[model samples]
Target chain A: MLRRIFALMLKEFLALLKDKRSRFVLIIPPLVQLMVFGYAATFDLKHVTYAVFNEDKGSISRDMIAAFHGSPSFQEMPQIERNEQIAVMLDRKTVQMIIHVGPRFTADMLSGRPAPIQIMVDGRNSNTALLIVNYAQDIVNRFNNDWVAGNGGAPPAHIVTRAWFNPNLESRWFFLPGIVGLLTLLVTILVTALSVAREREQGTFDQLLVTPLHPAEILIGKALPGFLIGIGEASLIVMVTVFWFKVPLLGSLLTLYTGVLLFLLSAVGIGLMISSLAVTQQQGMLGAFFFMVPAIILSGFATPIRNMPALVQDLTLLNPMRYFLVVLRGVFLEGTPFHLLIPQFWPLAVIGVVTLAIAGWLFRHRLY
Target chain B: MNNAQMRLLGLIRKEFLQIVRDPSSIAIAFLMPVVLLLLFGYGVSLDSEHVPLGLVVEQPDADTASFTASFGNSRYFSSVPFRNTPEAVDAMMAGRINAVIVLRQDFARRLRQTDGAPIQLVVNGVDANTARIVEGYVTGAWGKWLEHTALQQGQTLNTPVEIVNRVWYNEELESRNFLVPGLIAVIMTLIGALLTAMVMAREWERGTMEALMVTPLAMREVILGKLIPYFILGMGGLALSVAMALWLFHVPLRGSVWLLFATSALFLLTALGMGLLISTVARSQFIAGQLAIITTFLPAFLLSGFIFDINSMPPFVQAITHVIAARYYVAILQTIFLVGNEWSVILPNALALVLLATLFLGLTRLKARKRLE
Candidate 1:
């Protein structure tokens, strides 16, 4: 039985390799997707255009506008004449933020009165808009410090902020790690989902059944190659994310690999289950998509899982990608130890075991 | 009475039977987008709140303790106490906290000494956008607290500048407002392309194309027969999805219903034609599905500006997006659903879609096997 399983697995691998197109699909798309999505999926907003309505027309306001120009985050667009232009600029998405210094700015500051400047932000892209708002506030706060110190008064209630885990909070660092999980979902599920359907379509599935292989053996045989391919795809993405994108990987290599291995099992298992239900390649593709989209959206790749409502968060508990994303981020960015990763580790293990077992049972039951 | 019309009707009937028999396809077609919308709307949130934070207080004065208490009480942070900054950093790196707030030594003394003390804020910039928001929450809270403290101390530091964030169309900037509407376009494109590509390719693979060619059917009839059913199916899918978006997800429909349906139909024509083109080029269903997915899926998801902003993409990518049918549809959908049915916004995108659809349909011709041989 063991020898027969190995032979069947080898035959499946050979068949996959023989089809040049399938081989290409298995290998090339993952790399391409990694590169495209890695660069494109960034939430880090750069080159935010800001308009300054410097009513004060003083050195203080000019210096503040200069600070906005100095930062890579903000690009100072042409000055707006009327406040209405701010609305137009925002409407056109030409400027993400606008700063307005009041007309009595120099007089107010010289007379020991509070100097108020108005900052207007277009909140279309809320994440980027928030960034612009924060950066603007920082610049203003710095200006306040300089001005107050120059006037021979002490600044009150100094705030010291320390960002934990990811010091730079580079969106790429958080996103790239999650790419491992995303790529796993895309490749493994898609590849496995199509396997049985392709065989059925080509009339080879009957031939495979005629061989002296048990359905369990066939299930393992079908899943292992995809499992291996998923791992390879994940490793490639990890390399690009860590080295090329310069995302920090602070965790142990062993723990990361273990988590990846477990994650692939659940992904492949889900794919095999999708394959068992699909009668045709079209159904298979659709089935994979049915799983992939929800899995991705709910996995906390694009959004924070914590922000999810209670019911949705509970539903995400069933999604293997969620745990895998947690593991990937924990390992890559946080360098979480094995003990620290137990919550993530156990959920993945449970999902892998349950899904593979169900897949095996389905394979046995479905095959004639 | 033409043989072509009969043959085309027969093909469409056969396709519908296949779809009806395959209960999984129907389930997937209807359920996939509904489930995805619900998941995306409820499960995915770009707005950050209640993020875990670590706080380290160096000197325990009344002012320092009160300041720490203020941070702890804020709705944004679920504050966890740490021994020191290094310990907080370690905890943060261990994924225990989203951020850390450190009260420097002599913080109370500094508050008493001057109103211009320098405060340091360090944020983990792994997710740059989220990190920036985390910084905002911390600073916004701190600033408010500082104002109160200054008022108590009889020192007023007033800023003549205030920022008013006016979010138009979507007042709350709810991601759902954007994502739900975008899902309509994305889902429609996927179904039209994937379904047409498979069904059309299957006919060829089964040698039914040769049989159909022998009949008195015109090429136009054959194409129309295949196109109409999937078009109807695509529209049905769109209706179900839109209902889900409005009723279930609560994404408000601000535009004209007629315009939405009209633009969606036009967009479906382009997507269906693209799929037919793939089916014509690929002889096997497998290859057809692969071609369909590559052409339709990536463009619809990534290049279409559904999730990522196209303007932010590299210039070459932006240029390449002009040819993407989904780009036009996404703009149309966003405009209709979010910005309302303004003629100026709708016209250009509708024109682009119509042009692409005509081009794709015109390019996809019925090929004779005799010619190939």
Candidate 2:
């Protein structure tokens, strides 16, 4: 029985290799997509243009404006006049933020009175706007502390902070790890979903069934090539994310690979199920798409899982992408030990076992 | 009354019969889009909240405990205790927690003194947006605690600066408002492509096209007949999606209904014609489907400016979007739903859709006449 399954698998694999274009598609597109999506998926805001309206023209205002020019995040644009000009610039999105210094700024400080500076930020892209506000606050706080110390006066507030695990909070540290899961979804689903349908379309599926192969033999034979392809695609993406993108990988390679293997099994199972149901290649493609779009959206890749409603979060328990995302991030960024990752790991294993079983049953019953 | 018209009508009747007989296609056509719209609107959100954080306290004093307790009780964080810095860092690196807060042993002593001491909060900055929001929430909570402590000490504490936040258009920042309107454009493209790709291919596969060609029917009549049923189906999808957006998702329809229909019809014509062009070129259902997915689906999803902002993309990507029919449709749909009947926005997008539809329809007609060598 095992020999028969191996023969069937070899035949399917050879057929796939025979089509030069399909083979090129299977290998080349995954790498290309990995590179494209890795670069495109970044949320880090760079080169944010900011404008200053310094009425004081004092050394204090100049020092503050200089801080904005220093950071890589901000590019100081030409100074603007009239408060209304800020609104116009914001509406046109010429500048992301504006710093306004009041006329009495230096005098208030000399007399021991509070000085107020207003920061107006464009909120069109809320995420970027929020970051600009935080960076401005940090600069202002540092300036205040330095001024107080120079004047031989006490600082206003003492903030003692200790940053845990990832002290630097690099953006690449988080996203590169999640790429492993995203690549698995793209390659496994697209490849396997088309496999059976492609065979049926070419009228070769019936020929395989007529041979001395059990339904299980044929199903495993069909699934292994896609499974291997998924692993290869995952590895390529992982390499690009780590080495090329310069994302840190703190966890053990064994843990990451284990999690990825399980994740691919579940993803390939879903694709095979889609293939079994679809009568035509078009239907198969659409079916894969129908499943894929939701999986990606609800997977917590672009957004946080915690933000989802309780019921929706519960629904994600069944989604393999969610667990893989967790596991990928755990192993790649946090260096989470295998024992610590039980919550993420077990869910993926459960999903893989259940989905594979269901796919096997579907394939067996589908051949009418 | 002409034999050609009769033959074209006969083909359309046959297509409709096949569609009705196959329950799967009918179910997929009507049901799938609704499910997708609902899921996209409600299930997918970019907002971040309730992130897990690891907290390490060196002091274990009341003041430190109280500060840590605030984070524990807050809606945004689930605080887990950590033994030391390395363990906490391990948790963060392993993606166990999004952030970690550690209070130094002298936190209470520093607060008692008049001098301001610096507090450090470490965040995983991998997702820059999430990191920013998480940092803001943590600092805001800490700031509130400081204010209360200062008031208790009876010190005339003053906050020198005030920041006012104002959100426009979508004040609540509900993801549904943005996504539901976008779903209409995506679903319309799918229906148009699927319907047209299968129509000519099915006729060829069933060997009925030879009979139709020999009849007195003009090629124009045959194309029109094939398109009419799909046009109705596409319009039906549009109506259902619009109603779902308004009634189900509460996406306000501020634009003119007539304008929406006109623009959507134009967009559908372009999508259907492109699918027809695919069928004409490939002449096989298998290849037609592949061509349809490659041409329609990816471009509609990526280049149409649905999920990603087009202005932020590279110059070449932005230029490529010019030819994608869904790009114009997405803009038109968003404007109609969010900005209302602003003719300035609507007219240009509508005109673009009309131009694209004409181009694709002309191409399909020209391509249909050429036989395989």
Candidate 3:
């Protein structure tokens, strides 16, 4: 049985890696994706275009616009005149925000009254709008404090906030760790899900069924190749993340690998189950995607799980990718110890056992 | 009808029958949009609310009580009180709280004597976006407390720059308002590409291409026959997603429905042409599917300005997104759904779609002619 499984693993490797195009598919896309997504997937705002309509030509208003000009986060578009240009600028997608200072701006501040400055934000992309508002708020808050200090006294209270793990709050530190899990999922699911269905479509499954191999042996042979590929893919991504991307690995390599192995088990089990159910390679491809898309979205890789609705949040408890994401981010960012990660590890183990058992049973039943 | 038209009609009917007979194709065509729309609508949200925070007040004086009350009163924070800083830090490490607020021993003394009293905020910066949001909310809460205290003393606090924010297009600033439209682009790309990407490859793998080459059918008739069925299926997918976006998810359709349908048609042709082009090149279903995903779906998802802002990306990556059809479609969808008929935005994107469709279909025609020769 051991020899048979080894032979099957060899065959699977040759099938995936023998052809020049298939070899290229296996090696190059992940690297390209890593570089492409590393730069593209960011929430940090830069070169954000804003048009200023300073109705109050006072130094304070001018100072406010000057502050935006000095900051790297914003770019000032060519100044606009008519009230109509505000709508036109926003509609043209040329500007993300329109800063309009009211007429009573400086007088209200000098007389110690609340002066209103209307900021028309392009809310088409609400995340960018939120960040822009925060930037504007920070600039205004600083100006207010300086003015008050010049007059008589500063504010009596202020919060000195500091981010713990990521000081500058670089988005790269957050997303690169998550990319390790995503790339692993893409490779593992494709490798395992297509194995059995491809054999069936090519009329080789019947010959395999007539062999002396037991169902458990067949399952191991089918799953081991994908398992090794997933581990290799994960290791490559981790190396690139640490050395190339310069994200520090604070945790034990053992802890990270343990989590990855368990994750691969569950991921490979899912692929095998889809393979067992599919009659054709196309069906298997679609089935794999049907499961993979929702898994990634609900996993808190890009969007936070807490932001999901309650029922969907509860539904995420069953998703292996969700637990793996927590493990991946925690192990990379927080240096979380193994004992602290047991809760996540056990659920992944449970999913792996259940899915593998189901796939084994279905393979046996179909063969009989 | 002429014999060529009759042959084309027969081929389209046969493709339709094959699509209906295959459960996976039907599922990909009909069920995928529902799953993706609901998933995107409910699952993906940028609104960060009800963040859990830990509060450590060393001295519980009147000022401390009021200061803590501001965090507790606001809808954004759910503040839990801890006796000391150690306990709060433990909770933060265990992931129970995203941030901790520590009030020092001289809390009230500094408020009365010093010009600026210091309060410390330590945030879990694992998720940087959330941490930034927490900082912003904390500042807002602090400012409100100061304002409330000044009003009580009957002394007007001068805030020189008061911001009155007006969020246009989506006044409430819901993420779904734009996310729902972006979801349409993603769904169309997957369904169109995954569906037709395998058709020509499957024929080759099954040796039916050799059989079909022996017949009198023209290459143009075959390509058109393959595209017409999936085009209808892709259109059906668009209609389903748009209806769900409008009625189920409550996303406003501010532009003309006919125009939305027209742009969707153009985008679908481009997507289908890309898929058919990939199928013609790959010659096997496995490679075709992999190529479709690598070339079509991943680029559409990452580079299309769907979730991430394209302008924020590096310049080289930004240049790459120019060739992606979904970027234009997403721009068109967001404008049509959120902002009403803004031809300045819609016309440029629609023209790009037209150009991409022409390029892709023209490449596919050239490839098909070579295969026939």
Best DockQ among the predictions, by candidate number: 3
User: Backbone clash tally for model 2?
Assistant: 21
Identify the runs in model 2 with alpha carbons over 4 angstroms from their true place: A1-3, A14-17, A47-173, A198-207, A339-346, B1-11, B60-74, B78-97, B110-118, B126-128, B145-159, B183-228, B269-332, B342-369
Q: How big is the positional error of residue A368 in model 3, measured in Å on the Cα after superposition?
A: 12
lDDT of 2 at B146: 62
Which fraction of the native contacts appears in each prediction? 0.54, 0.31, 0.79
Per-candidate TM-score, chain A? 0.92, 0.91, 0.96
Worst 10 residues of 2 chain B by lDDT: B159-168
Candidate 1: RMSD to truth: 3.3
Name the lDDT value of residue A96 in candidate 3.
Answer: 91
TM-score, predicted candidate 3 vs. hidden true structure:
0.97
lDDT string, candidate 2, A38-129, tens digits: 55444544566879887886676677678678877677899987878876676555676888888887776666667788777754334444
RMSD to truth, every model: 3.3, 4.5, 1.7
Q: Write the per-residue lDDT of candidate 3 for residues B1-373, one digit (tens) a residue.
A: 9999989999899889988777788888789999989888988897877789899999899999888878764556688889999999999999999999999999889988766679999999889888888888888888888888887789866566788888889988898998889888989989888888999888888988877677778888889999999999889888998899999999998999999999999999999998898888777887877777667656777789887888788899898889999999999999989998889999999999999999988888877652542
True-vs-predicted CA distance for residue B114, candidate 2, Å: 8.6
Model 1 stretches astray by more than 4 angstroms: A50-62, A76-125, A162-165, A201-203, B1-7, B72-75, B81-94, B110-124, B218-220, B291-299, B320-324, B358-363, B366-373
Q: Which 10 consecutive positions of candidate 1 chain B have the poorest summed lDDT?
A: B364-373
